[model samples]
Target chain A: MKADPKGVLTGEHYLDGDFACAEGALAAGCRFFAGYPITPSTEVAERFSERIPEVGGIFIQMEDEMASMNAILGASWGGVKTMTSTSGPGFSLMMENIGLGAMMEVPCVVVNVQRGGPSTGLPTMVGQADMMQARWGSHGDYEIIALSPNSPQECFYVAIEAFNLAEKYRVPVFIMMDECVGHMTEKVIIPPAEEIELYPRRLTNSPPAEYLPYMPEDDLVPSMIIAGQGYKIHTTGLTHDERGYPVMTAEAQEKLVHRLINKIRLNADHIIHIEEEDTEGAEVVVVSYGISSRVALAAIDEARAAGIRVGRLRLITVWPFPEKRIRELAPKVKAFVVPEINYGQMVLEVERCAAGQAKTILVSHGGGDVHNPQDILEAIKESIK
Target chain B: MEQSRTEIKITGFGGQGVILAAYIIGKAAALFDKKEATLTQSFGPEARGGACSAQMVISNSKVLYPYVKRPQILVCLSQEAYNKFEPELISGGLLIIEKDLVKPKPAENGIQLLAIPATRIAEELGRRMVLNIVTVGFFTAVADVVGEEAVRGAIKDSVPKGTEDLNLKAFERGFQYGKNLREHGE
Candidate 1:
């Protein structure tokens, strides 16, 4: 269908926030979305069941989050781009599988439309508390790609980018669109079909017999052959040999796990993206991400207009921490301002990246009410003076 | 000579589809008309019976924030929303309320006010589910924020594949209702 450019229209038609999310997944070249319907998040599952088939893709509502996570991994092994969207409790269920995807080097996207939680905190309400959980949730010693989009439009593009990064590095990816952005509707530009860049599976001519799922000398990521492709391929949760077969010995396990984790961690410099504004000779700096980033922008911009030497650093990729860039700026900048839903998750990273070069301040907000640009701007003023 | 940003608030009960109405208005202003707009909805514990409001800011420049503290336009689909959000209405702002659902009447004499029977009009059109869309039709025709072409495009995707005709008819009726408001002095 040709996309409407004017970005508005009305009719007897109505859609809840969930259906738009399903559409976003489909448009992002997600060939598979495996999830079990759990309140709020179920809308994504229900819509995917109807829409994915229409797009010649697969949508399977797995029995549970664990099954859903593994199913996406299985689909990725079959050489298709796969994904799953879930919330907090279900996110807990999928953690072990996330660790496996990281170890196995499978490329896919996992969306956590976060709701409140110690466990099912507020099923229908919104929360940004999972900002830290996304980075350290799954038990692992590896780096992950996590994106938090402030709106649904960004959700569409970020979801596409999640798949792209996953494929580019051959690693699992995460999209952390909180309950607010995930369900919120905006005039999302469904870019004309020609503008979209969809990355297909990278296969090699080494053929079924010669293919080694874990052997790559040049590119950081290795190519794989599917189960029915006449390839003698092996996959594992256990540390394995180059051909992906599990070895009982510790030496092979150590080497395989080391390579898997190192692939993402060592290449962190390539994957990091942070947006900067008026930081030329910034004295006070405000750092934020996701929807909070919007307020940060306002805060910084308003401060600038008010003659405050305030700058903003908005993280595009929260994981793998953009430490190198922050470290580079440490000497030049005076102070660091970190605002997130959680009290001090990224603040720790910022303080470490600053390496005692600058004083760090934290502006935190939890569930009931989100902060305004004035609050952040006030912090910026206080930090500098 | 400076431009003042426009913030609009639309509110009603939870089941009234007020969020969708605010979203369509915001999308129209921001994406279709090439203006800057931000949309925000009321959330938290009292989300059921308490007044639900979605605020939108439309400007010719980048929207500084999404929070709408003072609104130039306020649409009330229920009485509670009218009372709760009425204080936020700007001087000489426009207020549109659903005649049947809200009572006690607003006391703001300076603001322009119009009352439409949205639910009753939608039920007459055969489906009450489109009460929000009906409200949107009135909004577009009254404010002229979104182009007719873009409104058609929004309607196509938002509505289901089968019921396009009824929606169009309802849109036309609601749009004309806004036009007829001043002519038939009630």
Candidate 2:
């Protein structure tokens, strides 16, 4: 399906990443937004509030992050695509409700324009520290899709991809953007509506009397029915069955939880997106995502110029961790050098995937800013040694 | 001007449109001139009368590292901003200042300096808020970093709809002053 023309702002624009994310949401048919404005991410909510009215959508300023997360879930179930944006402290507050969204199998988008963390660390600085939290913070054994964008252009394009993934899989999708990408201004090109493709909501065709809200159709994902559509439904955070009733038994828990995990696990190949360069028979591979990927490219160029056989692996989609590719490269490369704004969040995943086959060198920082290219270049040099 | 990349810093007190000046230059280079530019700014809980600064990197290719370590061009609109950021200017770099506002300290060898009374020129245009626009105009003519017509198009695209004529006049005033300085071999 093509994007709605009313929501598309087709032109060449000079904008920051936060504003670009908001435009992406609008273009992707997200008609409902609920958020409490926070630094480094407030521009997204501001843009949404200013633009939503023009497109005949709802923009709610909730009192706090908890309410904001729950409001989006409710809006999504009420038959509209929904989203919310926040930074570190606010992101922490939304975790419990994010778990609720996952448990309920609701389709929604959460954007974290990350700042320095571990409790109000730096309100207005950059950080990629929340990479692990995006995967594991919400709770027990559930899977969600996450994307990392390096620039304003990717922030615009990847945000639409985030929404489409959510709609396709019926799970919450996260956009983990750091303050550097969120605040930095650059050129972004938004394509025309017909050029953009969107995934329409999967509505069940069964009559009201025959519909089962939690019943899956071979794909492990269930078709959804909006409230007030003459279909009776009951949804909750507690473990529920196909009829949407709370079932406290262990058997019910196993059945419900397994479906939640398998939906994403079965479709992992479709959800993961990676960009690779020069990985063929290389001695070292630099693994990075978001802004770090671009920074790593400079080091890669310098390393290649100095006669080092180094390759680049940039993760456009961070979660559902490209385990297969990493494992394949582990035995082939001498080492995987990971450079991130955070101390060592995603490096652990890379190390696990390598699994003693190759050395994993983590070029870690505490993240008020991005990595120095020379520091990464030094790590790449050490990897070859 | 034909280099791979150039780093620039623009600084002033809050409410002086320091960030806006950087945005205009970045837009002119990235959008209008079809170059690549990334603009980043400082954001924190500073005091009411705090120094505000914005950094930009303009390149023929993609910008990898966003922050400006040693700026090749520094534009200071206030004494405090000049004092705070002057030492970070690279040797042989260009330093631009508001002649009425900043009494700059003398610098090392091979430095090029351009001073303009941008606030006075903006006042002559009957609006003091366009001082940053005037500074941008001066930068376009003298810096040789971004194209002149590109910056003009950027100013028109960015400023408020009703105030385009006033802002363009302010730009013309600063550009003429810069052209005069170059013509007289100053």
Candidate 3:
């Protein structure tokens, strides 16, 4: 479906990644935003507050991130596209409710403009340390989708993509942005409304009488219905039956949890998006995401000048891990060099997927800033040896 | 400007529009001049009275490394900023400063230095906040990374709605000063 013309601001803009992401959310038909202001991520909320009035939406400054997460979930259930943005500390606060949103099959967007972590480490610095946390922070066996954008232009598109995925999958999707990308300013071109595609909420056509909220359709994703539509519904985080009633039996837990996980796992191929360059028969491949991917390109150029057959595999969709591509490339490439702002988070997944068929090297940093291109180049050079 | 990439840095105490100046230059290059530019900034916790710096990289191709390694052009509006960032300028780089705010020692390694009284010019225009626009104009004429018309377009796009004329006048003053220095070796 085409985006709503009323919400779209189509033009060329010189904006930072945070502002661009907010614009993308608005363009994606996000009409409700509830978030507390935090550095780096605050711009997203600020932009929404400034523009939502003219866009005819609701912008609420919640007391805290916990309230922000819950409000978006409630707003999503009330049948509007919703989102919230935050950094490390706030992201941690949202995790428990994020798990609730997942269990309730709430479709919403959560953006984490990550900063150096382990507890408010660097408020104004860049970090990718939250990649693993983004995957598992909410707990349980349920699956969620995550995307990493490297530029302000990509941040705009990624926010829209995140909303679409959240609606389609009936899950809370994450936009895993870091401080570098969040604060970096660049040119972003927003296309016309008709050119932008949006995924409308998958509200059930089944009348209130026949609605069984937790029942999965052919795609393993159950259709959602707005609250107060009056067909007698129950939403809870506990294990439940298809009728949306809490059930204590082990069988109910198995059936509910399996479908929740399989909805994403079975559809992983469709949900995963990656960008590859020069990987065909290459000996060494650089696996990176978010801001690190752009930095790695510079090292790749230097390594190429020295005649190293280095390729690039950039994860546009960071979650679902693009496992098949990694497994396929692992056997062919001599080694995979993973450079991220965190100290060896995603490299573990690469190593597991490689399964000893090839070597996996981690060019790790503790964060506060991006890795120097020379350090990545040194890693690329060492991969051949 | 023949090089594929040109790195530029602007630094001052906060409330001096340091970041906005960088944003305008980057906007000129990326949005109007048909070049690629990336801008990043750093500042302390204090919102209005702390040291602030913004870095930009303009290139014909995509900028892979978002931060500047060694800036080829450095504009310092305060003495502290100059003292802090001067050593990071490349050997043959061009350094621009505010004559009233900064005191420089001696130039080394063939570095070209230009000074403009941007705050004074902005004050004369009845708005001291346009000082950044003045520096941007000076940069446009002396640095040669972005075209004058492009910077003009960016300024019109960026500044507040009613202040365009005053900012443009400030820009003209700085640009004229810079052109004179470059032409007759003032």
Candidate 4:
């Protein structure tokens, strides 16, 4: 479906990543935003608040992150695309409700403009430490879709994709942006509304008497219905059957949870998105995402100038891990060099996927700033040895 | 590509439009000039009255490293900014300063310096807040990184709706000052 022309601001503009993300959400038909503003990520909420009135939407400054997350989920079920943005501390606060959103199959977008972590470590600094947290933060065995965009331009496109995936999969999609990309300013070109594709909410056509809220289609994703519609639906966080009623039994949990996980896992091939370069015959592959990918490219260039066969694998989709591609390249490359702002989070997934077929080296920074290209170059050089 | 890449740093006390100056330059290069530009800034937690610095990299190709390592062009509107960031300027780099606010010691390693009374020019124009636009004009003329028309378009796009006329006049004054300094020996 084409994006709504009313919400699309089609033009070239110099904007930061946060503003671009807000524009992207609007372009993707996000009409409701509820978030507690935090540094770095605050601009996303600010932009939404400023533009939502003219764009015909609701911008709520929720009291806290938990309420913010809950409000978005409620809004999504109320039949509007919704989103919330935050940094580390607020991200932690939203986890429980995020889990509930997942369990209830509510489609919404959650953007984590990550900062240095542990406990409000650096509110305004860059950090990718939440990579693991983004994947497992909400708990339980449910699957998720997370994207990492490297630039302000990509942030615009990624926000739209986040919404598309959320509506398509009936799950909360995460846009795992870091403080650097969130704050860095660059040129972002938003295309015309007719050119932008959007995924409309998967509304069921079943009659009110026959509609089963949790019943999966052939794709394993159940259709959603808006609250207060004629259709009777029971959405809950408890383990439930196809009728959306809680069934307290081991089999019921198995059935519901398995479908929730497999909806993403079974369709991982279609959902996983990555950008690869020069990996065909390279001995070392530099695997990175978000802001680190841009820095890693500089290192890759330096390594290449020094006559190293280094390739680039930038993860556009961080979650679902792109394990197959890693496994394929693991046997061919001598090692995989992972440079991220966090201390060795995503590298663990790379190592596990490599499965001793190739080495995995981590170029880690504890945050506050991006890694020096020379440090990543050193890691790339070390990978060959 | 390395020779074509121009790294610029603009620094001043907050409320001086330091970031906005960088934004205009970046917007000029990226939006109007059709080049790639990335701007990143650093400042204290205060909303105003703190030291603030913005760095930008304008390149023909993609800017892989977003932050400036050593700026080739440094513009300082305050003495503290000059003192803090002066040592990091590359040798033979272009250093632009506000003559009334900053006091430079001596040029070393063939570094070139250009001074403009941006605040004085803005004051003469009856709007002291447009000092950053004056500096941007001076930098555009002297540094010659981005085209004049491109910066003009960016300024018109960026500044408040009613202030474009005044800001453009302030820009012209600084640009004329810079042109004079470059044509004759300064």
Predictions' DockQ, in order: 0.31, 0.65, 0.62, 0.70
Instruction: Give the per-residue lDDT of model 3 (tens digit) for A65-128.
Output: 9999999999999999999999999999999999999999999999999999889889899999
For residues B37-83, could you state the per-residue lDDT of candidate 2 as single tens digits?
99999977772358889999999988988899899999999999999
Residue-level error in angstroms, candidate 1, position A95 = 0.2
* Descending-lDDT candidate ranking: 4, 3, 2, 1
lDDT of 4 at A18: 97
Docking class of 4: medium
lDDT of 3 by residue, B68-106 (tens): 868999999999889989999999999999999999989
- Which 10 consecutive residues of model 4 chain A have the lowest summed lDDT? A226-235
Residue A312 of model 4, lDDT score: 93
Candidate 4 TM-score, C-alpha based? 0.98
Off by over 4 Å in 1: A1-24, A38-43, A207-209, A248-250, B1-4, B42-52, B87-92, B109-111, B123-130, B141-157, B161-165, B183-185
Give the distance in Å from residue A227's predicted Cα in candidate 1 to where it truly belongs: 1.4
Which tens-of-lDDT digit does each residue in B103-154 have in candidate 4?
Answer: 9999998899989999999999998999999999999899988999999999
Tell me the tens digit of each residue's lDDT in model 1 across A1-385. Answer: 2222221122122233455555556765677889987755666788778765556778887889999999999998887878888888998899998988888888888888777666878776666777677777887576678877776566666766787789888888888766656555455565655466666666767967677888855656787666577777777887778888888897987777677767777888777767888767888778777767876777777778778787778887888788887887788888999877666778889999999999899888765345676788888888877
lDDT of 2 at B142: 90
Per-model clash counts, in order, read 7, 0, 0, 0
Per-residue lDDT for A264-318 in model 2, tens only? 8888898999999999889999999988888888888989989999998999999
Compute the TM-score of each model's chain A versus the native chain A and list the values.
Answer: 0.90, 0.99, 0.99, 0.99
Q: Model 1, B118: alpha-carbon shift in Å?
A: 2.9
Q: Quote each prediction's TM-score.
A: 0.88, 0.98, 0.98, 0.98
Question: Tens digit of lDDT per residue, candidate 1, span B1-186?
Answer: 114677788999898888877776666565556666667676655767778988777777755455678888889998888889888888788888888987735556588887788899999988998888888878776765566556655665456789788877767777788767756745
Sort the predicted structures by DockQ, highest score first.
4, 2, 3, 1
